[model samples]
Target chain A: MNAIIQTNELTKTVKGKTIVKNVNLIVKKGEIYGLLGPNGAGKTTIMKMLTGLIIPTSGEIMLFGKKLAETSKEGLKRVGSIIEYPIFYDHLTAMENLRIHCEYLGFYDKRAMIQALDMVQLKGIGDKKVKDFSLGMKQRLGIARAAITKPELIVLDEPTNGLDPIGIKDMRDLIRTLNKEYGITFLLSSHILGEIEQVADRIGVIRNGQLADEVSLSDIRRQRTDYIELLTSNVQRSAFLLEHELQVSNLKIVKDNRIRIYDAGISAGQISKLLISQDIEIEEIQKHTSTLEDYFYHQIQGGDKVD
Target chain B: MIKLIELEWRKLDRKKVFGEVIIYWVILMFLPVFFLKVVFADNPAVHFGESYGAAIDLMLPIQMGFLLFGASLINHVFIEEYKNKTMALSFGYPLSRKRLVMVKVLFIALAVFFCSLISFVLAGITTYGLDQALEVIDGSPSAADLMTYVVRMIIHSFATALASLIPLFLFGIWKRAVIPTVVCAIFLMQFPNFLGLLRITLNPDLFYAILSFLGVASVYLSVKLVNRLGDL
Candidate 1:
């Protein structure tokens, strides 16, 4: 598959402080690419640079295989974006706002506008002024304007921000439908792990203005580790007993008097019984299955390179 | 470019712009007669009451009020967009920021020029009509007086349109200060009067030409430096 978006050493500096450092990212066409990072991690800044809202200090963005810059922005016509939040001429009605957007893009289709509003579930509110809209409604309206062009790519920054559960679900579904049905690629940024986990085909972990790693969701799932964890003050004796008696040799001790047993054929019940019979005090014990949350946590906290 | 200028107009609040234009028209239309009948009635140094030709002199300076109208547009088209982040939307478009700023400047200049020209005609008609009924000034308007008014109306309207943009670069786009933009307009409108009050003897044409040049320079700088100054 061809790359829809590529950034080479993308960096942005403001007021002599580096906001986004040397970062390289690639987003393939026809896939939902998620940028997972904490707040102020330069996700919006990167999106802004890609969308031509701001110029980068050092780096180049290739959109649709063309250089994205202050002057060479023809590729932006095929991209729709809402960097931080939805912005509109609050005094204008929703229809007027969308109309202005289409006119700028030189794309005019009244029926398509209606369909976009319908897709975002903002059909009947087209005639209403944007100032009267709730935050959720405004977000939906922003989505409507973005998808109204049916561009090749849509970049949404925290698309679920200020949305109810149903609205968030609707947004997620809308993104999926647009991707699946229309083949519109997406670059979505969010701090919520579950939100991205549900929608993103691939996730890029950004930490402190750096691209830590980019991996497919399936790859993370395949590498999911299942382990048995126990907290005991008498760590050395438990380690000895578990290895000598239970033949559990694949165990490792962690901080805070805790041990993680990765040995197969081991159960929390059997481990608890063994520890109790041995007169060893067990503070806590549980069988664990690592999730995307754990993967994301490790990626962010440890900045480890995952294969 | 015209399409982009039209888009700028579409982005604005039409009703509010219409209301503002109407207020400017009505006040400017009556200001010439108001000064002649009330403010300058007893003053001897002010000779706007001597004849229709003299009243044209007073009317020309009075029409500088359109500079304030230009300032208002700079607020609507430029400063307000910057404040509300709609400018970010425009930046996201395929067009460059320099082109966008150029279109906005052209829109403001064209709107101010036409509106000022219309205000001059309305003020001329209203002053003449009121003079016929109230006998505010000394003789009737001559063919020469009418000819001069028609020519100066066009020239001064164009000058006022450009002069109104004097603060656009510094106050409107750079500082994004609304109060300073309006204050700058007020100062530009009263600039000739300030020279008179200070006993300056500079020619009127020279002074207006200078103001108009400053407006053009401001516009040129705005378009040239927008890429750096236009960041949100």
Candidate 2:
């Protein structure tokens, strides 16, 4: 599988302050890739660079195996995007906005325009002026415009923004349907974890404008850590007995009196037997599995390499 | 390039722009006749000379009115797009910023040029028609008068186009200030009047040449440094 988009040591600086720095990224063809970060974490900045909205101060962008730069914009014709927010000619109707967008791309498809609007559930409102549109409608219209041409790749920055819960779900389903049915690739950016979690095939965590890690959902699931939690009144003695007697070193003390054993190589029953042999009272003992959210938290907190 | 400019036209408020152009034509079309027949009827030979050719010279100054329209276009094409962030959408297209800026400048230039030419024709007809009724001048317009009108029409059309682009670099792209852009156009249109008010004796042709150069420089800088100026 070829990578649809790749950035090598990409850096963007504005007015002597680095906004995004030394970032490397890969978005494979026919996959839904999500950029997960907190607000003001440079997610939009990186998206802007990818979509050629702003020039990168350093490094390079390669789209479809070709260099993307001032002289090399041919690849962008096959790319579609909405960065920051949906902008439109407020006085123009939805159909007019989409028509102008298509004309710029040298594309003309009235039926496809209608279909795209229909796909986003904005079918009957094509004749309505954009000035009267609600925020969610504008977002949906933005998606309709981005997907209207059926470009090879679409980059959406916070596509679910300003949307109701139902609208967010519809957006997620639309992304999935486009990816699965039309085989379109996506590069989505959002601060909402659950929103990305539901749609992204692969996740890239960003922290402080750096690519913290990138992992496929399957990879994370395969490496899911299941730990046994032991809560006791006397954690000091309980930890001592587990370490000295049971030899449990793959464990973390989460709270004052709780020990989480990550090394599942030893059965929970064996640990219980050894801890019970000691005189420490076992207040609670339960098995806990590390979720994707936990793995993401660990990756960000630990600053681990992207798997 | 034509396609890109057409796309730019589709992006604007066409009704408002059309309304503005109509208003400019109606007002400028009658301005020269009003000044020649009504205001200076008593001293027509002194101010407007013997032939209606002098009425055309007044049309030249009145044609500078389109500079304001050019500034308004700068507001619509450059400043409004930036304020609305639709410019970012254009940047994302498979077109370079230099090309995009070029298209925008040329669009405004062409619009101003076309409107100025139309204004020239309207002012000429209005002045010629009104001169018959009012008898403001002593003699009929000669072949030389018609020739001068034709030559000035082309030159002033080009002048209007260039003058419209004068605010592109400074006020349109850099500061993105709407009022400053309009003020710049007003200053360019009234430059000769300002010099006259001060009793300055410089040649009007020399002043127009200087202003034309300024307009060219503004356009050059706008295209050359578009990468820096077009940044959000």
Candidate 3:
């Protein structure tokens, strides 16, 4: 897989406090990579470093297979981003803001600007000054500005932030369309699991300023922990009966009170019946299938801040 | 660099700036004559002596008025951008922060410089036109008086342009405080008046040289330390 962005131990420390630890992230070409973490989890810091908004303390950033730094930012022209928030000269109209952004990249296309606005469903509202825009409208216009040049990659930090449900859905669809149709790679960060789950092909889970997991959604789905948890007063006896009498080897006693059976061939009813026959009290039996949220939670809980 | 300057211009509120500059021009142009004719007419204690030379000298101190305009540009270009988080947008662009800051300083310098030069012309014309009607002076402007006016126009305008940037390093870029930046300009403009209160006489040439030095040093430090201080 070709990586559009690769960071080697990219770290940032501000005011004697490390905000982002050694985070080695990879976003492949033509893929939507989502960065998931809680608030103050260094998600924005990482994004800021990636977009050259903040300098890294000790690390290397490779974009388009080229190193990115303060002195060498030529690769940034082919990149677009809106970090933290959608900032604009509030006094200027949406179209003027987009035009100034384009001039920076040396990408001048009036029609493309209008087309990008149209894509965000902001067609005729380009004449409206940004100061008069609501948060959602500003977010939509920000996306329009980011997508105007149709660059190779766009890094968006909380793109759907401050949007309604319909706006969120539109943002998701826009990301998917840009990825699939234009082949524009995206590195987006959001704390909303459902948002990432809907649009991201892969995810990099950040916990305490460190990347705890970088896995494809398919891999997460395949690795989903599905098991039947049987709670009982006597877990040792229940485990003994399941292992010896029922010949169920794929089971483990958990928390000194429950046994989790991973072997799906044996039903929860069958396990309960065997435990009951053995005079072991079966308090509860539940089949658990971990969703993305649960997986994210487990990942975060499993990983702590890098020392 | 020119493109970057153009971007800065587009980023600002042109209408507000133009309107503000027009007001400054109109007010400063009429001020010299107003003070000479009405405020300090033949006042014995004030001792302006009712001369055209004194009126011209008064223009030099107030021409530093553009320093306030400099503060305005700094507010728009530096402080407001930081407050609004728009500086991060510029940082995310392809250009280096140093180059971006250089453009901002140049924009402010150019705007201040040209505005001051134009202000000199307007004030000169207004003072001359009012003097002709009132005949406040004994005779018409001498060849040497015209020479002084021309020379002051060039030096004083240049000094005003540079003086306007006096706050760029301290109040404009470092403190990022709007009120301090404007107050700094006001204090710089009132330096001679403050000296007058203490009965200290300073040479005008030396004062202008110091202001010009401040402008150059401010621009140098701004570009020099952009990497250290330009972070969002």
Candidate 4:
């Protein structure tokens, strides 16, 4: 029960083209798991498969400790999702749309409907048609609909898509509140690394239809490194001076001109002063911190095939 | 299953659907009288005005207009949902895709069948009232004629409901094209008239039976292949 969603070798192929390849993903209960990748990285496809919106070509999806298949979709009753984007009958009122969704889930609590609307700050607009709402309101209404049934798992794809900065922050806060106060597990997909970094407990980097890596934000934070990088014409002199004069043993000279110093005790000013005292020409120097953005970029564009 | 079918209606734009149905009803209600009092008034060869029993023949084909309504419902229930990506929302529900598709197919069938049936009753009353005023037909409807009209009304409406779904599997579900679906419904609604113009002699019951068979086949194929084709 700890893992609300477990997929084994989950693959999806459309017209002989593999969209998602052998994705073994596990989303634990009560954790906000973010799927991070560039556009066309199969993040939506994986979310679609996980939510039973689309069937995987070859894989096993274990949801809520039961096998998820076409016949055995009882797992979906406890799941709510917004795949790709929030879709509604635009001609219908927001309350009407939510009512239909609840009816489909066999949920018929009017108070819960009102509570979900109020929870998303969408109160007093339930009678308004979705077509009249702005994109931000629609996104919030989508979350309200998804969270209406108080499902155990809520999967949202790009929940902050097409929102203003304030709307995005509100969405992030609403997601956190739903996850923490309601004890709901979240599986969200976003191309925005900072958004994921802010909300997700763990992040899964998807590249070229495959999960390149899955790591916790805390682990990534722990692995975060700070180093001083310098651009100098004489790379050999900078390296020798830093090693002998400053005892900067952990260092690397990259691209024939840039030296990176990983010595925690030595500052950029100290390295620059040491190099200047040695009469070595110092072009430029700055302290650098490796962040999740760099980690995501490396996973996306660094090693794997990026088709 | 019934609840699922009802949900299909609840999910639709009720006002729009009602507007469409009213338009169909208003036009169809007076169409038979229009044909007798205007369209075929001078055409002595068209003996549909000769008797109530013969008039039933004209009414049967005229009410096939509901076949187009079936097409319209398919557009709303299936095609529009697919286009708007709302069908993906239904797919995410706990129900199987096949079951969901089955509900939609049944909803369309029931809507078309009842709408066509009510249309028959309305057209019957309108044409009769108009006939009372204008004496467009030769005599009043006999009990036999009334019974025959009622019987054919039930059977033909059922047939039209099924025939309307003929385009569902290929046009609605598979291709998801709007124009083609409506065009297919138009062709189906006018099929008998085309056969008449071509001087093709076919049994009416046999023809409806064939159309009903095709409609059932379409529903079967839609339910069977929905899981494969229902991906958004």
Candidate 1: regions farther than 4 A off: A231-259, A263-283, B230-232
Q: How many clashes in each structure?
A: 0, 0, 0, 0
True interface contacts reproduced, per candidate: 0.87, 0.74, 0.91, 0.91
Candidate 3 whole-model C-alpha lDDT, 0 to 1: 0.87
DockQ of each: 0.76, 0.66, 0.74, 0.75
Which of the predicted structures, 1 or 4, would earn the higher TM-score when compared with the native? 1
Q: After superposition, how far is residue A115 of candidate 3 from its true place, in Å?
A: 0.7
Error of 2 at A270 (Å): 14
Interface RMSD of each: 1.1, 1.3, 1.2, 1.2
Residue-level lDDT of model 3, residues A1-307, one tens digit each, is: 6989999998888888888899999999999999999999999999888888999999999999999999999888888888888999999999999999999998899999999999999999999999999999999999999889999999999998899999999999999999999999999999999999988999999988988888899787787768999988888878888888878879887798978998868888898788777787888999988788888887888843221
In the range B71-99, model 2's lDDT, one tens digit per residue, is 99999999999988888888888888889
Report how far off residue A171 is in candidate 1 (Å): 1.2
Query: Candidate 4 clashing pairs?
Result: none
Clashing residue pairs found in predicted model 3: none
Once fitted onto the true fold, the runs of candidate 3 whose alpha carbons sit more than 4 angstroms away are: A231-283, A303-307, B44-54, B142-144, B230-232
Order of candidates by DockQ, top first? 1, 4, 3, 2
Q: What is the TM-score of each predicted model, taking all chains together?
A: 0.94, 0.91, 0.91, 0.93
lDDT of 1 by residue, B22-47 (tens): 99999999999999999988898889
Residue A12 of candidate 4: its Cα lDDT?
96
lDDT of 3 at B144: 86
After superposition, candidate 2 runs with Cα above 4 Å error: A234-256, A261-287, A305-307, B41-45, B230-232
**Candidate maximizing lDDT:** 1
Tens digits of lDDT, candidate 2, A175-208: 9999999999999998777788788999888887
Give the distance in Å from residue B46's predicted Cα in candidate 2 to where it truly belongs. 3.9
